[model samples]
Target: ARRHALRDGVAIVPAAMPSQANVVSLRMPLALYGIAGIDEIHDSVIEAQAISKGDGIKGRAHHVVDSQGASRIGRYGWKADIATLKDMVANAFANELGIT
Candidate 1:
């Protein structure tokens, strides 16, 4: 029901439970859009925010944070939680699904 990084980290085979597939399965594609691939996630969030600032939506302007506590426009996740792909990936592995 979960995915683990293989020794090579090249291909994503599968998990014990395909139905309960790991968060990676759900996250990888989405994360790709967030990290490696494009700025679609950020663009969409920006465009939507520009059109309508939703205090209602689960994610709004989730600015990024640094060690100094400084932050910038968050371009990832529902709440725009993190600012960078590295952080996003880390967060994903840590707490995205709440399974761990």
Candidate 2:
């Protein structure tokens, strides 16, 4: 019963047996933390507005409130809905472990 296998230096694991329960098909990758701070992301948003491209797509900053009720620019989630790493971890605790 080989549940896990490794090939080409990559870990090949078994799929979720619960049928679509832990499967992510269209998930977008987020940048690693410590690479840029919240202030840097916000600054990028500001700099993006100064671009003078040919009617290019404009980027919008998504703001979310953290657990401490502090407003912050979202850096996680599909639409940047999650604000901080702490908030994302808390959400995982509630959704995955059923802990509020």
Candidate 3:
């Protein structure tokens, strides 16, 4: 079951240097922040807006819940799915390293 789960969890995404790499690695560390800090950063980021007739693109902060059940802005992952640095680290350990 664990092996199957790991196999399914692996994702293959396109890269700029296709010949050099196959999978994107979690090489960088996410900055740690308190609940208030996360909220502050989230508020500072530009809110998501609808595309206008001539608008190009707009990005919005993804909202997520922390391990403690508090709401927070997702600051990790490509889709902003992970809520906090601690969560991200734990996820990496469990999924990538099978440490859990």
Candidate 4:
């Protein structure tokens, strides 16, 4: 994933990139476990509008093209690889907590 992001001119920063620092600071193992499915990309335009300003999650939505460049492809999975963390969490809660 890092290699592809580099090849396509995606600036691969450490997981500590400013917008992402807080999430990493959390000490919860449960939160860390699903991170890979959360903070994977950034979309400046849409990000500006999201409730979290697009900075709270850990993985990127798979089908949504990265805003940095055009030659790359998203490589994650869940909900056709485009599922949001909220969706993943909701599904997990339904199965695990029977919230529904």
**Backbone clashes under 3 angstroms, per model:** 4, 0, 0, 6
Which is better, 1 or 2, measured by TM-score?
2
Compared with the true structure, all predictions reach lDDT values of 0.58, 0.68, 0.67, 0.47
Q: Which residue pairs in candidate 1 collide?
A: 1-17, 1-20, 2-22, 59-79
Candidate 4 lDDT, tens digit per residue, 4-98? 64668778466545864555343432554657644455544334443354567544323443333343333334434333455455655686568
RMSD of each: 14.0, 11.1, 12.8, 18.5
Best by lDDT: 2
All candidates: TM-score = 0.38, 0.48, 0.47, 0.27
Instruction: Report the C-alpha lDDT of model 1 over 6-33, residue by residue, as the tens digit.
Output: 6757685565666765544543454263
Report the lDDT tens digits of candidate 2 across residue range 4-28: 4465465757765796567566755
Best by TM-score: 2
The lDDT of model 4 is 0.47
Q: State how far residue 3 of model 3 sits from its true place (Å).
A: 32
Task: Give Cα distance to truth, residue 51, candidate 4, Å.
Answer: 32
Q: Give the better candidate number (1 or 4) by lDDT.
A: 1
Candidates 3 and 4 compared by lDDT, better number: 3
Alpha-carbon runs more than 4 Å astray in model 3? 1-55
CA deviation > 4 Å runs, candidate 2: 1-55
- Return the lDDT, model 4, position 10: 73
Name the 10 consecutive residues with the lowest summed lDDT in model 3. Answer: 43-52
Clash pairs, model 2 backbone? none
